[model samples]
Target: MRFYRQFRAYLVRRKVWEVTAYLFFGILTTLVNVLIFSVAFRLLELPWPTSNSLSWLVSVIFAFFTNKLWVFHSGASGTRSTLWTLLKFMLVRILSYGLDMLTMWLIIDAMHGNELIAKLITQVLVVAVNYIFSKLFVFADSNSG
Candidate 1:
């Protein structure tokens, strides 16, 4: 109860309900990725990395739609404007993906850290990066100075 009260206070103070919603949708995206990967690799007997790549692709598409419509409520209108915003979103995600790989390599290989711990740290960094890029670049209001 005390923890819940403290969490609620933090949410009210920060007004970061979007972060909460993003996390909710992120979980759904993870589930979708895992389900697709499992079906492709185990049931359909696809190649090892191919299944993973396909799953990631589908999940990214799912995430783009959900984040634009639900999480950030992007105001980009017109086909060109929307496409531009999507391109920015994809670019940011691609950059973050590179960062994730670099972080994992630095932590696990260079620093001799555990793989799971390195991955967790990398994921946290990626989430922060994605949120910042999405808010400032992909979803920023064009009219705002």
Candidate 2:
């Protein structure tokens, strides 16, 4: 119990708690994306691109709220400020979506790779990219203006 408390204190002191929370939520978001994609592509017999887009839509919405409330703890209030934050978040995510599509196209269409494999790989890349964008631009304190 003491060791656990010490470790927890260290994590907080080092500001790793925020990252740990982000990673936890990021995993959940990824699971949501992959599950939605799998259902749309395999069960519903949708095309890879369509399935990918559908999954992206759902995951982005999930990510936004989680990131705001938990990950970054933006604590942004007011209708205008919150809406502005949402808009910026969506814009950056749209850019990442384009990257996702391009990566999928290159892997599955051009390289003749497996669609599921392509999606998993794309998710890894997209998650990293999104984290950077969220930290630097979307959820950044300066951008709160």
Q: Which candidate tops TM-score?
A: 2
Candidate 1 accuracy as lDDT: 0.74
RMSD of candidate 1 to the truth, in angstroms, is: 5.9
Off by over 4 Å in 1: 1-14, 97-128, 142-145
Segments of candidate 2 deviating more than 4 angstroms: 1-9, 142-145
**Residue 52 displacement (Å), model 2:** 0.5
Report the poorest 10 consecutive residues by lDDT, candidate 1.
115-124
lDDT of the structure predicted as candidate 2: 0.90
Spell out the clash pairs found in candidate 1: none
Query: What does candidate 2's lDDT look like per residue over 49-105, in tens digits?
Result: 899999999999999999998788886788998999999999999999999999999
Please list the C-alpha lDDT of all candidates, in the order they appear. Answer: 0.74, 0.90
- Supply the TM-score for candidate 1: 0.66
TM per prediction: 0.66, 0.90
Clashes of each: 0, 0
